[model samples]
Target: MQLNPEKDTELSQKVNRETARLPWSELMRHFASGNVVWIADELDLVDVAVRIAHDDKASVGQWMAAGQIAKVSDAQARDWLETDTSLWACVVSPFILVQQQKIRH
Candidate 1:
């Protein structure tokens, strides 16, 4: 199957539109959610937003509405984790562990 250049471009534009609308605060909230998968996905989202915002603050809702970014799902989160096991150990898994430790004390 051949790629349709117009459709691809349109699709990308739509994605951009959706992503750009996500506001920065909401983005951070998503990052803070208890679900490791949600945090992992939002981490990727924030990485992109930080790059785009450069020095400016952007919102999650803005990015969502702008369609510039695609939200990550649980399956995608698993792929990300599988690709970097250390990431899971150091990031997603440990945060909960650390918080739990603190709570236990």
Candidate 2:
């Protein structure tokens, strides 16, 4: 299937705009419902959200296999609660993809 670069770009920009920094506390309900996916810090949270939105199965599968992305675990949720971690989050329906906010110098 052919991809439209313009459409893809627009989607990426839209997702990027929707991404925000949120405290873990604010996401507890979603976590409890198992609708939160943890993104590796090395990955771009917005890019992951866009891929999921586009239904890029191959890329999503690879990330899942590599453990770069997965549902938030109980242990992780507890840790985040303890530390009050702030995350970069973007929603792609059924799931909210999140990553540790990058520390800016």
Candidate 3:
């Protein structure tokens, strides 16, 4: 089977858009339940803003204090991320654990 380049690009863009539009509340729940994951690439940096209320610094700050989400440094991500190594962030924990996307259909 052959893949259409245009379709692939369109789908990729769509996924990214979806990620950025994720609601902050949902992200908080992900942190609370340990169901969060992300890629460690430059694009991952943009991925952080995908959370719903990411635009509201106040709300984000509150979530950070409550341990719902967190932003880690590059030095910190270097510890485990060796493959596509890039940006690093976290969901409630001090460590960053990015998972590769392999479930997309």
Candidate 4:
């Protein structure tokens, strides 16, 4: 059954149920081509980071601090849609995690 985000609780510290998920393969393709992906997935920021980058969850936080990854709002994602770096993804939450490299080693 499809998850009803409307009936769920907030995803995490900064994310909420308003988030959504996108297919991963297409996401990877877009990222591989050097495009920015605005992720609206409702996930632990760490997990999302880990999923998208070589760094583990802990390292993901560091990446965030280092500006390797970023979190954006739905509005920002929407605004970005028209930009060159406008690729997007959402796995379950409202957090938008982005990195400038490959997720796998």
**Winning model by TM-score:** 2
Model 4 residue 40 lDDT score? 30
Candidate 3 weakest lDDT stretch, 10 residues:
95-104
Model 3: residue 74 alpha-carbon error in angstroms = 17
TM-score, predicted candidate 3 vs. hidden true structure: 0.30
After the best TM-score superposition of candidate 3, give how far the Cα of residue 63 lies from its true spot, in angstroms: 28
Tell me the whole-model lDDT of each prediction, alpha carbons only: 0.34, 0.87, 0.39, 0.40
Q: Better model by TM-score, 1 or 4? A: 4
Q: Candidate 4: which stretches are off by over 4 Å?
A: 1-57, 73-79, 84-86, 92-105
Tens-digit per-residue lDDT, 1-105, candidate 3: 244667656645554444323333334434455445443342233233333223446644555566544443344334433443332333323322333222222
List, in order, the clash count of every candidate structure.
Answer: 33, 0, 4, 7
Candidate 3's displacement at residue 14, Å, is 1.5
Model 3, position 7, has a per-residue lDDT of 60
Q: Give, for candidate 2, the lowest lDDT window spanning 10 residues.
A: 96-105
lDDT for predicted candidate 3 compared with the true structure: 0.39
lDDT of candidate 4? 0.40
Candidate 2 on 1-105: residue-level lDDT in tens?
356889888988898888889999999999999999998987777778778888889989999999998999999999999999998888899998889963222
Model 3 bad stretches (over 4 Å): 21-26, 43-105
TM-score of each prediction: 0.25, 0.92, 0.30, 0.31
Ranking by TM-score: 2, 4, 3, 1
Worst 10 residues of 4 by lDDT: 7-16
